[model samples]
Target: MTEREPDSPVAEPATALGRMTPVDLSHPLEPGMTVWPGHPRFEHELLQCYTRGDASRHHRIALGEHTGTHLDAPVRFVPGGADIARTPLRALTGRAAVLRGPAGDTEVTPAALAEFEAAYGPVRPGDFALVDCGWAGRWNTSASLEPWPYVSVELAAALLEREVRMFAVDTPSPDPSDSRACPVHRLLLGADALIGENFTHIDRLTG
Candidate 1:
């Protein structure tokens, strides 16, 4: 875990906020961070530095739109679909229902989701349905390679049926790494629902 900056202010714990402490689900952007193969690698170039006689320190960052933690707008796969700027903020933020997947690099199927709902409760409409498969733990490592866990197309349909505002996962993509057709992406984005990928620290939400 990354330590907080010494000068940064401390945030209140969950107990202080009625058991609702905000959890940061984003990964830190940096050079050489793990990204899908064939995608642009993250880069950071020092632009100005006070030690170099410049007024301030700054950097020039270069990365793909899908770098690190990111959201997929309808335009990503849908023709003439709404772009990120047009996507409503309400759709991305809401009461999230975190579904914890079983251990290993397996497909998240409808049966697994139904089992989760049976244990907890049905995923309500307009909720951000985050599926945590623990893949974020492999970030920046060789284990982040292809064949990572992914959501099945059937589960995508189930989420769409539930009318979830967003279907998010910790892996690089909702579809399998070797997928050519990207069935899950098409199924969700085609319906105007957002998909958030590469989210880290999703397990913290349960805590």
Candidate 2:
């Protein structure tokens, strides 16, 4: 088990005059939810059910850490990096920018990221930079498992230059599926930056 710090207090989101517009960025996790190949699939079993004459209901759930909409900590790729328990919550909560890529591409390059900046200003420090590659539409299908959009090492370097709080993607892994060396994961997470993967509904945020 990893040694962890005490839980920190989390502040509630600010509502405008008690009204809040919430955007759900996560995919629902079910018994048959899609998972990365070679990873255990999500499973759920009922421990107690009202239909079975039980007064209350409960369930036993099992899933990998990377299942569904999830965040990856530095410990995922870097030695001696912060684990989920040690990662600060504030790093995952902040202003987020949705960067759209050109249609029909499997790789987001440094030049595309530069184009994004040219249009929406530089990705400011402390922002969550989400790359939208139109891949979320392929969620849960075999096609999603195919070579999906991923960030190039150069783009990873540029994102690191911006000191982003978190980097998010709509695919399973930001690095190539067959990569023996995951340089992007190491570069970002090793710097204590967070990573959100398998994100859905990112296209809804893109202009």
Which 10 successive residues of model 1 have the least lDDT summed? 12-21
Q: What is the lDDT of residue 128 in candidate 1?
A: 78
lDDT of 1 by residue, 1-207 (tens): 799989998767565577566789999998878887799999999999999999999998889999889999989999899899998666666777778776676888887678778877888888778889989888888787757888989999988899987989998888988888999999999999999998988888751
Clashing pairs in 1: none
Q: Give the Å error, residue 202, model 2.
A: 1.0
The C-alpha stretches of model 1 lying farther than 4 A from their native spots are 1-19
Q: How close is candidate 2 to the true structure, as a TM-score?
A: 0.86
Q: Which residue pairs of candidate 2 clash?
A: none
What digit string (tens of lDDT, one per residue) describes model 2 on residues 8-48? Answer: 65345464424745678888998877788788989898999
Q: Model 1, residue 166: displacement in angstroms?
A: 0.5
